[model samples]
Target: MAFGRRRFLAVLSTTAAVLGLASPSAERAAAATVCPLALSVSAQVSPPGGSPYTVCSGVVPSFDGTPLDVDVSLPQDSSGPLPLMVMLNGWGHDKTDFESTTPAGNGANTYHWNNAWFTGKGFAVLNFTSRGFHRSCGKDPATGYTYATDPACAGRADWTHLADRRWEVHDTQFLAGLLVDAGVAAPDKVVTTGDSYGGGQSWLLALSQDKVMTPDGTSVPWTSPKGVPLHLAAAVPQYAWTDLAQALIDNGRGSDGLSGAPGDGPHEDPVGVAKESYLDGLYALGTEYGQYAADDPTADIPGWHARITAGEPYGKDPLINQIVRQLADYRSPYDMPVPPASVRIPVLSIQGTTDPLFPAVHTAQMVNRLQAAAPGYPVWTFYGDLGHSYADNPHQVWAAANDEANDWLDAVLAGSQPTTARTTLSTTACMPGQTNATLTADRFSRLANGSWTFTGSTGAVTTSSIPDGTEAAAVDPIANSGCRTTPAQSDRGVASWVFDPPSPGIITGSPVVHVTATPQGADAELAARLFDIDPASGTQTLITRSVYRVTGSPGNVQPLAFELWPAGWQLQSGHRLRLELTQSDAPTWRPDNETSSLTLSPPVLTVPVRTS
Candidate 1:
């Protein structure tokens, strides 16, 4: 069943039909190659169930000589050379994790595990275990260092440092060399796509320059066997964090509910305040799978652990905290040091608006920084109401995100898309259980703005086993219950504002919320929720929510800014838009320390109402 150029082109037509691409025109049909460059492949043939693909597995030496386990799947019926796609796994996961359904039941993924979907479209996929995970090899030299021992050495080679350019990025560069030297992939036609950590790695590979700096301050040339600069065509990073510190701590909000305020918190216990249960799980995964060394039990996981235990006044009191912060700054992809303009790669960034692990703000911030550096880089985005994994949210949302990703890959590889230009965002939105009601936008306009004042509570609620955080109305709105009795607002430390629109419209894009308030105490924690209220029944359906921490002089009024998670929700005539303000939401946020009254002024919710 070997496919020549003609056969490969024919197969593409079938794939196009399935993917809803343009009808295969005569020009495309006569085309012999799917990729702009020819592929060079070396693999072992495996034919299962009468279908065939070339598979190969082996250990490749990383830049620092660490052994990396890599698996490659090549098209069995290729007419000529092929394009290469490298897929990386998330934290603590080996390459095989992508081959099956995620434990969280995100989307039943075919792209990660089965090569057929990609191979059928004429791509060679290379999946590799990151160094220090699974069968890969790397030693955390810091594992043996302690505060009583060598403090500087203890911070080196920590788990969080796993993604440092000197390590993971080097490993990727080394693997690219192997593929090119083996003549299985074109040096310039390679693209990387990964989820979470894997997604971050893809960005690292695509954005990194031809030179990498080692820990000892040594510069090494990152080049192919032929000594050419390592050139990666494009990247797609889904649910990936650009700033590790922001991802783990700081939370873009300071201690005492203020953003950019000094110190982690009054006590400096970031783990407890910033989602303890969730972060602890991540720590456990990294420790169990980090495998710093098979022989050593005392290798420090990473500098964060040491800093976390040290607590507040993070950078000053404990010198180690300062060291770890420097380490994080070194590895950070966004922020100071590395100019955003330097990491310009055409990117299709996919993020979950409802994700608890790596909140939607992370992607929004990353995009803003990237745009700031390179004003018009070709960056496209798809923000779905998804959680950490696709399955963490609703199935319908995953379908939309997954399908759009496929279309992006096809268009980019075909040269129909540009990599450096203003980001052209996709307009696709999804809602679960809606068969007839579509998620589309007509026109966008700002509904007139107003604000309200509410009391901020110092009282904290007990945590629930169910882990219900900020429930977004776009994803968790009451069903046909809108047809039943009206839902009442929670009387517990909450404020509400109701709006009646002149006409029916869809809420599209990110909605901006502005609040002017003075905290009765030193600081206050706030959560905002948007609801679509049924006029007849007064039933309220939650559409989206956002949380913020405000800090300032106890009695001084300051303006606070935050956005409700982006939504593409439908609104009908006579429906009321209600904005709910609350002081505390257990599990999602730590309740404020004091019973602070918030002297709030009129808050404005400017929704992007689709008018057409």
Candidate 2:
């Protein structure tokens, strides 16, 4: 991530020749008509034997006059306005995630999509550091690096709003508008694509359409500093969340009464369970690599993490619930008003079936809502086993998904129909030496054409009073890079059911579970896991799971119904589908700290299967 100075005069001379300008002065005069802000050329990057591209690195003032670090890469041969691709990074990462050749945070390799690659594809790539990360008005407390120079942030740190529409999303729109005004990018051919945190921003940008939300909470036409109108042509959001609350702190009570299924309206109250490990990991990364406005009372990042980490009595604190809900709802695209069809654009959402953080369900919910609101809007989704967790075929899945996304973008820019299917699902390679397979359907639900149900009452299963050690240890989304084994049943807190399919098939959707539970304390939680038990080796591979929080009188019987995280895996004839109902799945999920238990009746498990 070196930004060595390049010969600016010589580069400008060369750019003039490429642009057919008579001299450097002519090129400067031509650019002066469109570009009002000063730009500095930091470095020139060329992919091995490829045409060199200029990387102009500088700062752009956002809506509130906050300086945002930005890098604009332009190909030498491109003439007139070029199609733009705004490359974004994940949580706790900066623009370097798309610049450097080396791997950065979260195993993100630049070879996948870099400045040179996009420039080679005839696109002008814009990569910028999000606010409170690296150089964009950020101060890493751990390293004593400061970029907070705004007058409002003079006495304190300028914290990240976690991609709030009014801040991070607006910053992107404003930057894109600048590029459009500078005559560097086409006004109608701009696309936003990113992973994880940036993925969330990508979703927001697409939803915002031709308008941007102002600091005063009003919507205005997206325009540049020079008054040039702009809009997003397409968006490719990978491993993103439609609803922040449902993704991070889920209550498992969806509006449709089907637990994890896409609800009919905005997410309701009763703040959900905390995903302790993921939340803590992100907060730590922010503090270590980025910056946090820890002392700012208006900042919610510090306060939200602290309150959730305090543990237990979750629903009892009314103020804490308000903080959590307000923070999540404002940042979630699911809660936003549906955009009109006139401004809506094409979207190709890519998600990981194995991603524990933002699973396929998030994208599914978004696609469902979008289609419901604006029918035939050219929205497509590709679900594969490539994300935060272990992927059976990482390289293969990654390549295919990215290739599909690029093809979709190409088609959009060309004003043609894409050849890729509307909905594509990739199954994990369960058997030794077997390659992952993909299936196509018109809709997400069609991928799972059939189901297998196990119903009947057995005996009540009680949970352990302790939270940590007594809980079953399953897949660590961060640590387990390779396929790992999980226990089918634990001694104290886990209730298990084994179902043997009559024939071989593929399970391709979320599994719904129903049970009647009586809480030993005022509040209780249940973690459900679905595993594929190999009949020959007697090994269990964790497929998908989710956690549900139960709140009621101590002895009241609550009929708990929820869907496990969606997954796609091939099941053998002799292999068994084991459903484990446990009180806690530690590290991955924060268990209730109270010394309480949940007594459950025999559960009914319904798993979706694909015959063809």
Best by lDDT: 2
Give me candidate 2's TM-score against the actual structure: 0.88
- Which whole-number lDDT from 0 to 100 does residue 552 have in model 1? 67
TM-score result, candidate 1: 0.68
Question: For model 1, how does the per-residue alpha-carbon lDDT over 107-159 read when each residue is reduced to its tens digit?
Answer: 43332224444555577777777766655643223344122232322323423
Instruction: Compute each candidate's TM-score over C-alphas.
Output: 0.68, 0.88
Q: Which residue ranges in model 2 land beyond 4 Å of their true spot?
A: 1-37, 49-51, 100-112, 139-144, 148-157, 254-268, 294-298, 391-393, 430-434, 468-471, 487-489
**What's the lDDT for candidate 2?**
0.71
Q: What's the lDDT of the predicted structure labeled candidate 1?
A: 0.51
Q: Estimate candidate 2's RMSD in Å.
A: 6.0
Index of the highest-TM-score prediction: 2
Looking at model 1, residue 485 earns an lDDT score of 21
lDDT of each: 0.51, 0.71
